[model samples]
Target: MQETRVAVAGTSFPAVRQHLEEMLPGAVVEAVPVELLRSGGCAAEVLVPAMCRIDAAVIDRVDGLRLIHQWGAGLDGVDIEAASRRGVLVANVPAGVGGNAESVAEWCVMAAIAVNRRLPVLQRVLRSGAAWGDPPGRSLHGRTAGIVGLGGIGQALALRLRPFGMRVLGVRRREDAELAGRLGLAWIGGAAQLPELLRQSDCLFLCLPLTEATRRLIDERALALLPAGACVVNAGRGGVVDQAALVRALESGRLGGAALDVFEQEPLDPASPLADRPDVLATPHIAGVTDSSYRGIARRVIENIHRLHDGRPLLDCVNADPAGAQASRDS
Candidate 1:
């Protein structure tokens, strides 16, 4: 029996190695740092990357690489075209994994409430020894929350927010009446109804993917549509919102506040103006990263490894080049 070799790039998550070891007894899992990935030192048949930009150059270095398993749902960093051309299948553990969706939804809700309650302002005042009641706060009860995507994460968030007596509105690329009805959404529609959602929502949550259509989906015009002093919580990809426009809105006080887990440039520049604003809450992109989520993702990866060992198709295979994938499998 040949030992399965897995290379984990970019992240230093100990759980990944431990899980792979316990699940695949003879598997060799190497932790490849970001520097090695950048310099093209990935030598493995299976590559699992977390927050590492897997471009054409990196792919070229790994000769026997057959799979690119993303550690999470976000795949904006992976070059799907390059992987497809190189006959490497790309897979991701989507939000359907209960833990991942729930974690992200919880984070989104926390962001919304934190921003609306003016937590940042209160913290600033407390630290500066100023009057405690300088900034008035608001509550989510009876307010409307517009979710930009009606996917698993959005639905989870809606379920969590309902207990607070909040009205949830969702918009997706395609309208699903049954899903909306099941979720008990106030209203759900396609992109055409986004303007209405913006106008009505007291708090807006962005949960959409980062595609060409969704890139900069929340720009100046969209921000202007929001009712004054509206709060924005973005747990989706950073590129989905126009950073410059968002900064302008925050700086000019056109928008009340924002809580962002993702940014246009990750590890957001220390000198970035958005980092300094009292009304803006910036966090390292960690909405979907939790202990339970990692365990769930590990199970998926283990399942895929079993399938690969048995010469069967992998789960959640995003880049489907049947002929090419088959060739790689055979090799």
Candidate 2:
């Protein structure tokens, strides 16, 4: 039998090569830079794309390539339509936040409390050595937290919120069959209920996807529904909330505050109004990305490669194709 040749595409960290070599014994794996994974000269049975682009035509070069293992959850870079048409199995690792949800949830809760109590103003007084009485901070012990797009991250967040003694109201496209039995979580209808959920929720945490229907889902009209003191945390796609409208609401004091991780424009423009807002706590999209999350890319790649070589089920196959996987099945 001929030896199986696999190409490792897109590098994560320097140690990935050593770890992968030890995991797959006897497998002839070539660690090539992401730019060269698709070069015609490569004879890889399996192509693991880390940061490599898998456009519609990427598969043409690797006529004998079997699988395309991805490093991250979002497959926007990978051309699913082209790969699905060409019969290539694309894999991803959602990784379930790997305890990242707790940190993110903690950040969101802190932002909410920070604004609710007007801690920034109090901090100013404290810095100047001025005395101040209790700032009006609401207790999170019994507030309602509305969670949108109840997916892996959403579920992770909801579970963590349980200890806070908060009422968790979920506004999703449909009821999660898995969390259906869980108490404290009440499914509050569809997108129509977003306004009402906003009115009722003390804090709204959005963990949604970016789809055509979901674009601007939290625009101006939705912002008007929230009570004056309601807070928002968008850990989801930024397109879900309208930035311009959000800034206006924050400026007018119609909305309490916001904690935004992702934004419509990544590496957010310096002059954006939200950046200077005292009520806004904006992070550089670091909610789910950690060293552990980075390793997830490599681990998922190894798992997908093993699945393809062993003829087992491919995990996170976003681009599911037959020939793309079977091309090297015989080899």
Candidate 3:
């Protein structure tokens, strides 16, 4: 039997390769760094774009590519239309399925608190031996927290924040009163109500994906809607907020601070102005990179691979009909 080839386009290659090999002894998994993959040097039956962007050109370069499986829920980086045109299947492990949502929710909650308390400034003060009470911070209690994108992660965060005595407000693409009631959110509204949400939020959390409609959704005008000294926390795709607008708001003292886990650009430029600011708390996009999430994600990936081998329909396929694709391949 010929060995099945799998190419991984992000970090944790060794661990993923080992796991897949152990489970499917006849499969050959190799790491194809994003740089190499972009330069048209990938040849595999399955492509796992863990943290890499798979565009139309890169997809065309990979010979015999059948599947483009994302390690987590965010498939914004993949060009689903292009993959479907080439008869390739694209799928992702949904946020809540792999503990990814819970992990990210925890990170968002921590970030919200950190920015609210001005943690970065406190760290600097401690190191500089400045006055102990020079930079007083506010408490989460009795403050309004507006969560955009009421998906798995947003819903998880809402539930977690309620215990902190926060008045949680959620905005989804559509309104879900039942969900709001279940999560104990003070109120829930649709996207059109974003301006209302912003005006009331003491701390705003962005947890939506990046798309045409969402790119820079929180621009200068939107930032102007926020109450002065309000903090911002972003665990979603970086492009959802305008970096320049955020910087201006922070610099002009219009906004309190920001905590960011994801950036518009990966491997954020070291010399970027946002890097060393005391008011900005930055993390390198590891919100959902926990052991619990990875284990569950790996199991799902393996299951899809096995399904592909057996001519069975793949799970969570976003583009292309899985059953039809499998049948076409068999024929």
Candidate 4:
């Protein structure tokens, strides 16, 4: 039997290596650095890409690559079409199993409350030794929260918000009447109802994925629908919301404030206007990245590898190609 080989691209993260080693007892798990991956030095049966570019050029060099298992949920960085053309199966750790949905949910709710309460302005006032009563912060109690994309993170957020005495509204691909009743969503509808949902929301949470249809989904028209002074919290792909339009809305006071964990261009340009705004809270993209989440990701990778080696079906195969997975069966 040929010993299985796996290569990971990123700064050396020991936990992932340890888990991969334990799962594939005698197999080799090489921690390839970004420079090497970009230079086409990694040649392994399986590739684990963690926040590294896996473009078509990089894919062309991996001679016998059978799988491109993502270390996290986001596949935006990967060249899925390139991998598909080469018959390489691409997979990711879905929400419930990875435990990241809960972490993201907490971050979303926290941002919503933090921005609405005007934390920065209040802190600045007290630090400057000025009286604090002039700027008031709003409470989540009795307010309506509109959540777009009722996926794992959205469902988790809806559940978490109930205790705060807020009404939850959701929009997704289809209206799940049953899920709406169980999740206690005040109302659930499809994309057409988004305008109404925005109009009613005091806090709007964008948790949708970035697709061709969803890119810039929340632009000037959508922001204009938001009730004046409404707070926006985005834990989803930044491209989903029009960053330029958002800035204009905030500048004009049409939208109250925003808490953003991800931006259209990451390491968000220092010169950007949103960086220093008191109403905007911008954090590096670390919403779902936690120690626990890393471990969960390792487990998902292990499970998929086992399935691939044993000729069983892989989980969360986004680009479901029979030939890609069947190659592993033949191996």
Model 3 per-residue lDDT tens digits across residues 1-331: 3578998876643566666677667888888877778776677989988567899988987998999998788898899999988888898898878788999999998888888788998999999988898688889999999999988889889989999999999999888899989999988999999999999999999989888999999999999999998999999999999999999999999999999988888878999878989889999888887777777888898888877777788889887464765667744
Q: What is the C-alpha local distance difference test score of candidate 3? A: 0.87
**Residues 9-80, model 2: lDDT tens digits:** 555433545545665677787777656655654666666664456776567667576666654455655777
The list of candidate 2 runs beyond 4 A from truth reads 1-72, 85-88, 95-107, 114-137, 175-183, 291-297, 309-311, 322-330
State every prediction's TM-score relative to the real structure. 0.93, 0.73, 0.93, 0.88
| Candidate 1 TM-score versus the reference | 0.93
Tens digit of per-residue lDDT, candidate 1, span 18-131: 777776788888888888777758678888875678898888877688888887777888899999988788888888673888999999988888898888888888999987
* lDDT of each candidate versus the true structure: 0.84, 0.69, 0.87, 0.85
Clashing residue pairs in candidate 1 (N, C-alpha, C atoms within 3 angstroms): none
Please give the range of 10 consecutive residues that has the lowest summed lDDT in model 2.
322-331
Per-candidate count of clashing residue pairs (backbone under 3 Å): 0, 2, 0, 0
Q: In model 3, which runs have C-alpha deviations exceeding 4 angstroms?
A: 11-26, 131-134, 322-325
Summarize candidate 4's per-residue lDDT along 45-156 as a digit string, tens digits: 8998855778888787677788998876778878999998887888988665677888889898888888998887877888999975868889999999999988888999
In angstroms, the error of model 3 at 200 is 0.5
For candidate 1, the C-alpha RMSD (Å) to the true structure equals 2.2
Clashes of 3: 0
Residue 238 C-alpha lDDT in model 3:
93
